[model samples]
Target: MGNSSSIQAADASGFTQSRSLSRSFFGAAALALVIILPGCATYSSGFAKVEQAAAVRDLDGAVKTLDELKLTGADEALHHLNKGTLLRLQGNYAESNKHFDIAKELADKLNAISVSEQLASVSVNDTMKAYEGLPSEQLMLYSFKALNYLQMSDVDAAAVEARQFDIKQSQIAKQNADAKYLSGAFVRYLNAMVYEAAGERDSARIELQKALDGYKKQNSGFPVPASLTADLARIKAGKPAPSEVVFILQNGLGPSLHEATVRIANPNPQNGSSLLSLAVPKLAKRSVPVARIELSAGSAVASAEVVEDVNDIAEKSLNDRLPGITARAVARMVVKNAAVGETKKRSNELGAFGLLANIAMDVGSAVSERADTRTWSLLPGVINMARLPLPAGKHDITATYYSESGAVLATRVFKDIEIKPGRKAFVSDYYLNPPAQAKAPQ
Candidate 1:
């Protein structure tokens, strides 16, 4: 699976609520002075710096400087919108959504009643016209809305919104290559997602390729949100459809060392069942299987074997000459000739999956006072066993590092609070401690 960082929050309301009026007054006085004084290039210079920071992924710097701009009350909506964009880059979706909502509200208030009515009609022409008057801040808001729609599996609506943005730019004779690329690429991406969901493997692969090409041409590289890349790869490979499987790898999280590993096998060897595997190293002592689905048609039947601990096999020496592990011993399946479809009915069963382990190193011959040991899992998208079904409320998730034999070395806990969904409001801080070192008995 492709690994990448999460999208940052792009909400701008926090900046607007705190620094609107005073900046407006100061900006007017500065404008008058600019006419009298000749050396005032601060505004242009500052905005340029912010843009540069954003391009390079320095989101914090971009947000800090953008917040300092002193736009008039008329431009307040746009300012908040820009802030939202910065937050989105930082992967704060909830806050980014808040800014988008606020921007929409402000835009509604400023527009003529008739203009609002026309926009509400959802006509492309009318929406294009309405978008033109919007400040730069809201451009990203439209982009984010389109992205959200895609996430919700509403491809048609996303395509419509993207088209509106494209048409509006053409009508105004304003060319934003980045915006154009994003609109085109996103629509294609959504189309691919729809095709994948419908089990049209070839069609999905073609569309995803188009989307990837468009994004690369526009931004000169793959999109920053790495999740899309993994999805694209899965589609191209014709593995468990994107809708049927989820990849949990993200950027900034350290290497997945002990997470589970999953593998899928085909029951009928001739038709070549799709084989998919992922290694999740951050969740548990060994990786857990996220999915091990079986697919078949008519007389052709295929099964997937998901193994959690492949490390055991890796640990054994080939010289040992032992049957390390077998596929049937570790996986679940569905047979087309089952008397009563028992396999199909119990497809969700995970208890049957087993690990193929090998004894890598013998601790019996160790001479040191402390022994260090490491284990690995072979599946991807497995959630941390300790952090599953987090209760609704705010929580701080932490990861602790350990030295092979299980000696705690360091711990890291994220400060950002995540709101869970529940009335009782469960709030707790999680810890990731390093493994401890084992002491040999004297």
Candidate 2:
């Protein structure tokens, strides 16, 4: 993330360099060389390359590359700005701030004289247009500036630049949803961090939730950073201690059906496990061939599945009764693994069902069609549940079915379910149609 001081430096340095370079022969040659280089040229080619490396968190490379760039008559302000950004990325905040201050001074000088009035008058739209035709090096410079602001906790300013960056990127070529989502998410998260720093707990919470929601909508299950998680726990507990909830599902075979026991493992001493069970019918004539079961919290299935199958064989006469059998599998479920948080309940919708709806929305419209087309087998499989977790909040639930060939055969999302803590929320009654279903109990 970029810091405010570093951002000040980057802006000052970039503008100053542009101005000075415009007047210097060597500066012009350097710019020309950048233009002539292959699109995949090394990072030493342009000023923006340093910024690009910083954006991707490659601080060392960015710093080393910047040092090697022989900028004849480069604006001192720009040099300091680049140096400050690299320093910030390296965690040398004090040094970064010093450089930023120098860049700011240079900027002040230029602003006083109204040097490069044409560039100074560039509108946001013009900047956006220019960004479209910008070489990779220029794009990197913009990225570095945005990141510097983000790190400095000046989210609003960073957002403005980020938006410009996105628009310019789109004008150059079509933008991917993932890329857009990442940029948006980073902005939201930085804003939330700023709120947290300001001691506005409620506002911080809201921003953080928004950030989480945005990430979920994108179907990106990136884990919440530890700092953010700590902030939420503090808010919830009205104190400064960390707490986490873990859900575990243990599967065991019974005489006639498959039994699953779910338990919550709270790290805090004050919290206790909340256990539940789901009894699935076993196959009448043959043993259940359940290779795996996946579960997740907040109305969704788990992130992982219990997959190792247990086999038991015993010699039995035609007239002898079969012996009882038992096998076990385990899965861990948690809220953070979900792409989105719980879904809000709508009228006539149960909590788990509402969660499913949210899942469908997050996953997108093509999911059902894709499921029907046997794409489910290719997708990750989630165990379907009639009962789901909803702790006095919103939740979304989804189940994806996989074929024997490991292709996604179907996917279903249950949306907008509300359930109070210690209460039960039921989901829509649905069943998977499969050859394995006949072998498993109803």
Write candidate 2's Cα lDDT for 1-442 as tens digits. Answer: 4698899999999899665534443432333233223212222235445544643447688788777765432235456655765575475655765765565455445433333432321210011111111122223334345445544545565456544545544443353333323333334444454444444557667656665655455343334444445456666676632112221111122112122233333353112111211111122122322233333354444432321111111111101211211111111122211212222223114334433443333232111110000000100111122223345665655555444556664455546544434333333211223332323334
Q: Per-residue CA lDDT of candidate 1, range 1-442, in tens?
A: 1232222222355456345544543443343243223212222224545555654557788788787864444345555566665665566655766776676677656555465444322211111122212222233345465544544445566555555545543432244433333334544554555555445668667767766665565452223235447667765565664112111111111112222345554354222212322222222222221222222222322222211112222222111211211121122111111211222222213222200000000010010011001111111111111212243444444444333455544444444334323211111111221112211112
Query: Per-model C-alpha lDDT, please?
Result: 0.36, 0.36
Worst 10 residues of 2 by lDDT: 370-379
C-alpha TM-scores of all predictions: 0.29, 0.27
Candidate 1: misplaced stretches above 4 Å?
A: 1-34, 37-68, 73-78, 89-95, 101-143, 148-183, 194-240, 243-442
Candidate 2: segments with Cα more than 4 A from true spot:
1-43, 46-65, 72-82, 98-179, 218-442
How many residue pairs of model 2 clash at the backbone? 52
Native-vs-model 1 lDDT? 0.36
